[model samples]
Target: MTRMKELRKKKGFSQVRMQMLTGIDQSDYSKIETGKRNMSFEQCRRIALALETSMDYLAGLTDQDTPYPRTK
Candidate 1:
């Protein structure tokens, strides 16, 4: 699954709700989540902000996906 879908689920955000929060259309958001559409860096950043996740995590560049790192 794409990071979008994973993060959305983790945040308990539905497609419509996420779209509303991100000012993106539901269909477009769905496409982005499915990787059927290419999202811009700004769009990804917005999603990361909305999901309370880091851009690196959203882009799968790192395993530390959570917005806030867990304190040991």
Candidate 2:
């Protein structure tokens, strides 16, 4: 499973709920989670935000799941 799917499940979110949080359609979200579709950068940002994680974590670029330091 994709890290997105793993994170979603860990957070107790279903595809429908992920869609609701990410503003992506349920079917599209399912495809993204299942690795059938590539998500755009904006979609990744949204999903990361919704999951309270960093884009790097979602993309598996880093094992650390904490978001980067926020700057105002």
Candidate 3:
């Protein structure tokens, strides 16, 4: 699975559900998850927020799922 699918599944959200939350159409969401489509910055931010994850994670820049890590 691609990063998009992984993130969405980690949040237990279906493609339709995620699309609804992010205001993206279901078809578009499917394409994104399958890597057939690219997401805009705004869309990426909305998806990250909707999934309670960080943009960095979605973009494969980080392995941490959360937006912020707990201080040790």
Report lDDT (CA) for all predictions: 0.83, 0.89, 0.83
Q: What's each prediction's TM-score?
A: 0.84, 0.92, 0.84
Whole-model lDDT, candidate 3? 0.83
- Between 1 and 2, whose TM-score is larger? 2
Task: Give the residue spans of candidate 2 off by over 4 A.
Answer: none
Candidate 2 differs from the real structure by a C-alpha RMSD in angstroms, to one decimal, of: 1.1
lDDT (tens digit, per residue) of candidate 2 on 1-72: 378888888999999998899899999988888888999999999999988899999888999988898889
Report residue 58 deviation for candidate 2 (angstroms). 1.3
Question: For model 3, what is the alpha-carbon lDDT of residue 36?
Answer: 86
Clashes per model (N, Cα, C within 3 A): 0, 0, 0
lDDT of 1 by residue, 1-72 (tens): 377787788779999999888888999888888888888888887888898888888777888877866367
Off by over 4 Å in 1: 68-72
**lDDT digits (tens) for residues 1-72 of candidate 3:** 277787777778898898789999999988888888989999998988887778889888998888865367
Error of 1 at 55 (Å): 1.0
- Return the top candidate by lDDT: 2
lDDT of 2 at 44: 94
Rank order by TM-score, top first? 2, 1, 3
